[model samples]
Target: MSRDDKGTISVRLVNEALLAFTSAALPAEQLLHQLGLVSVDLTDTDARIDVADFSKLWRRLARHFDDEFFGMNARRMRAGSFAFVCRAAMAQQTLDGALRVALDFFGLTFEGFRGELSRSESLAEITLSETSNVPPLRAFSYFTFWMLLHGLACWLVGRRIPLLAVELRCDEPDYTDDYRVMFSRNLRFARPTTRIIFAAEVLDLPVRRSEQELHSFLAHAPSNILVKYRDTTSLASRIKAQLREVPAEQWPTSEALAQTLCVSGSTLRRRLADAGQTYQAIKDQVRQEMATLWLADASITYAEIAERLGFADVSSFYKAFRKWSGTNPGQYRSLILRADEPIASRFP
Candidate 1:
């Protein structure tokens, strides 16, 4: 559940996301197959989809529909709408100014819903409200809006603007665990309004990304925005980074890792438990991320990937990959290769 482990998204989340397509009477099953996901994947409540594929789904829908918001709003968010917003915000002097500019753009662009930024003495808030015409947005749409705004705010200031808490109006959905990892763990569902609360001082942080960096950033688009900008200060992120410096076979035992971090094994377990993570989960996440990254390279054989990931054999790797991504590694690779413009190549 660590943010650093943006390797897979829950099947529950995928279902919630598909609600948009279903509501619009779009062909959801065909889209799933195009992304190498089968009906069986949706049937498993515990299954997960590779994050890259999920991003592809986002872009595919956006381009074909010409609505970046996935037709969730009455007014279409035209293709390249987000890019224009980014450009407008990039000229602002501070995070506060940048956020206001972006929020204003969204306010004018979308017909029914608008984002507003306000602050009390100690805390700042970004609240989303339905103004007039459109139907109330689903919980998934609200969260997706927050993700884009929050992610962009972090990138603008070149830091993770920690959320004090998140207030959602809709009832908490089944994939609450994913929400905990994506936003703050201190989520309040069935609240009066849907807004993100954070410390006011972040408003003063300078907008640090330059025009040149913005080009590359936009090139990656929604995929980069989805997986990047996680709060890396978490203990899990630090330990995951430590694990990545060596082959997975050489990763330390839980007790040994705790000792290195200058804590007792019991304390380490307790701390990670508080964060909804476990030692084995972290290891699996690291392995899963590496597996997908390596699979992007056609030269790497299944046996080689297995050996490198510290798997005993190819069969074991296949089982673990299936568990992690809900698809075999070969099928995953085929999906990537089949993408009209593969997301893997974009990263390279």
Candidate 2:
């Protein structure tokens, strides 16, 4: 397909791919015809399509086959402009250079989407903002775009896997199994916005693609993909974000936390206890998750990790690592390093 014509791969392709593994399925031509009538004029395989046209078709198709349409849309819709820019950036010699490329060119890729790669304390958040009226499709499109970006980054770094957590702004449903399968994480639904949370350390992974390879990829990068809506924050999501900010080392005592949250200490404790967790427990859980990512790298030493985590000393770091992982830092690092070697070897 021509670059402009290659909007997003249609849901027809995905459905066909899935049907390949099953028997007694819909015919490919029939499926394609139905998708075409609902979406773009697929009969003219080379026809160009933009976000507005795609969104209209998606809304129509969604009404007829909400589940299938949303599923396929979630898988295919991506940040086409961002993808092109990222591919170009990957051609640069260093990660820093590539990041500069993203910063400089991201605006040129998508007109409405706003993105910021910013540092908050020690954490670097790559935030993407999408303002659209159709919240579900928009959220799904952004979710898919983030997944593609994450997947592409892993592919470049030679770590072809998903991130730690994929947070979605959509409502809770039985989509957990599919979300986990796609994102490889603790999937959170009914949140404020769609986000893929990973360690900032991932940005340090070395770029493997050469300038020529990147040029080739960008030369044919798909650019006419549709945009979808992402919704605003809900009350529960606001609470979750507030709790997320209280990392283990920074978590206050129950009374202190309750006061900070503007509630009585006993009430706060009782609420969390009823949810089957305590404030301390959630803080530890978040810390443990963060620690796992940090420990996976060989370059970071135990002392440095302890200091970063606000631990008292190496002994404390070791103890906590063992408690969280059931293994010492040395053993955990060894296992990760060994797993990493094969990935590195493939890229090399």
Candidate 3:
């Protein structure tokens, strides 16, 4: 996907996430530099970080501190804690039971703070509270915990669980739009507590994932956890998912896609416009994401990639890729293939 796509994280968030490293006097600069970030990238207040690199930063921090909680709690949540929790939770019969297992594990891993699960007739909630003199948790801590819990829950149930609402105890941050995109749009800040509410019926959803499925999921690690489970029920997301199922060469026109979705062409256009999207933009995004993924495979040639992505020719693919990423395909491929090389050698 393009760097400006939904798969990117705001620099404000990147800075906030690095606070733990900064406070601990660790080598945040070295880590970011190794991950292809520079002084200008971090100094630019308006810049963003690619989601893939951000995920890599997360894994690096966990390894460096031996604390997956990012030093937010007095207790160190050891590196393998999440993996262990996932394995244990997998044996549960339902999402409600699975979440209880996860909450219990985290409760045992950390100190002072606790997570509680409750349900009304129609809604279920996960609430967090601190019981001791532990330092006050930041908004990032709460949101990160939610991402883990919610992401695991969705994986266990084999689908995205739409959050009905989210209540945060801290004041709103500048990255609220990112939160809206990641979790729910109906967010409330400075509330009495921090909790996520969802449909109570989701509690009974059977654990549909197998051990093999989970092994594959864990292989991608904390990075996939960040971007894979965002709300996919939007009209745009639904369309994108549908298009991804078929080859790009077979992708339908806007009118045909509208007919397939059981709406008139005008209604389809109007709804997508209302959602701040266009048919052509969605198509471009699909091609962009596919092109990037394909570029990572050494066996795929440029001519073959262009044909697979439905470009008329190699030159046309080059032009479209440059438009999407601001760099030509060859340069992008060099950067991707040499990601482990020195920073100076990897860029430009």
Candidate 4:
């Protein structure tokens, strides 16, 4: 899917939902009209939907069943379930604290299931540690809960926390053409457990929300959450994610990267400019990170690292490295080696 398509969702996400409603013998046509749907077939898995439309449909369903989970189970997860969690979460002073509260909220309310908070030196992760069987939570439950926490986490911190990756126990579904939209950062499927990986900095981000803000936030409920968190990525960062997939010896040019994201050169530049970022700055950052990793090896020659990082010559690489690190690559490597930090430690 193209970048702009990130804001829309595949109808596949709604197929199970529509079927569940249809099986219950709801008048499908009337229901579709009520939800502002244009199409007659609610089961069109290939059709795409604007997230706003999807959110409206979701709210209608939630109110109809009085279950936020849309009868995914016998339990009625009342309409206020999300609001109550938000109220509790808003009290926390930091994203870390708020995340814990949200997780515990799910654990206590969604019995038999367990969730966890963990961290590596560079990542803060949340995972569903156990599954429930009392009535069994469906796979969609896992994603909803994960997204709730991720979205709320972003809301709490007042910034996108850079959700780096997602791991799912189920295989990639047919409806995920939209997943590549804004969520193209990283998506993994058929993993052992459902998980969301966040950049470690998220742990320390302070909760910028307040009681006043909570009111506006709660007023929107799941709609605000359903919308993809777009601010989490900059054009440069998006490019960097793509760069990792390419051969390090060369990186995509600005025009090429813009084309890859399906935007024009001017549009990309204008958007990046709006974000106070420049393409060159992003390119340099990607190059720096790659160079640091190569230099950490201690086997690759400086010239080879230079060549691979796309430098015109060893001297140019030296100049750029010095500008980036305030020290030569060798010294940066030695410092990290002495400190016993990985190459990634070179950057914040």
Per-prediction TM-score to the true structure, in the order listed: 0.64, 0.41, 0.65, 0.70
Ordered by lDDT, highest first, the candidates read 3, 1, 4, 2
lDDT of each: 0.74, 0.49, 0.75, 0.66
Top-scoring candidate (TM-score): 4
For candidate 2, the lDDT comes to 0.49
lDDT per residue as tens, model 2, 1-348:
222222344443333223432235655446545666443343453344443444444443434443322333323223244446667767866554565576556444444444555433323345455455445433344555554455445445545432444556567542233233345335556555455544455566678886675555433322211111111112222343465575546656778767867899788767776655666555555565566667756688888888777789999988876665445667645543442232211101
Off by over 4 Å in 3: 1-3, 23-27, 34-40, 132-136, 232-348
Clashing pairs in 3: none
Deviation (Å) of 30 in candidate 2: 2.6
lDDT of 1 by residue, 163-250 (tens): 6457676787766876766776557676556677666778888887788988988777666666566533378888877988999889
Write one digit per residue (lDDT tens) for candidate 4, span 1-348: 444454466677766556556645556666677666665365575567877777777778888768776666545668888888888887877778888888887777764455788765555567665543233345566666666777777777776554445666667665554443334335656655566654556677777777888888877755676663653344655676788777765677889888989999999989988877888887776676677667646778889988888778999998997776455666655533332322121111
Tens digit of per-residue lDDT, candidate 3, span 1-348:
222456677777777777776735445566576555544366676777778777777777787779887777778888988889999888999999999999999888877767888775555678776663334467788888888899899889877786655777678776576776677655767665667766677889898777898888887766676677773336887787789899998999999999999999999999998877899998887787677667756799999999999999999999997676555667656644542342221101
Alpha-carbon lDDT of model 4: 0.66
Clashing pairs in 1: none
Instruction: Assess candidate 1 and give its TM-score to the true structure.
Output: 0.64
Considering TM-score, which of the candidate structures 1 and 4 is the better prediction for this target?
4
Better of 1 and 4 by lDDT: 1
Model 1, position 316, has a per-residue lDDT of 100
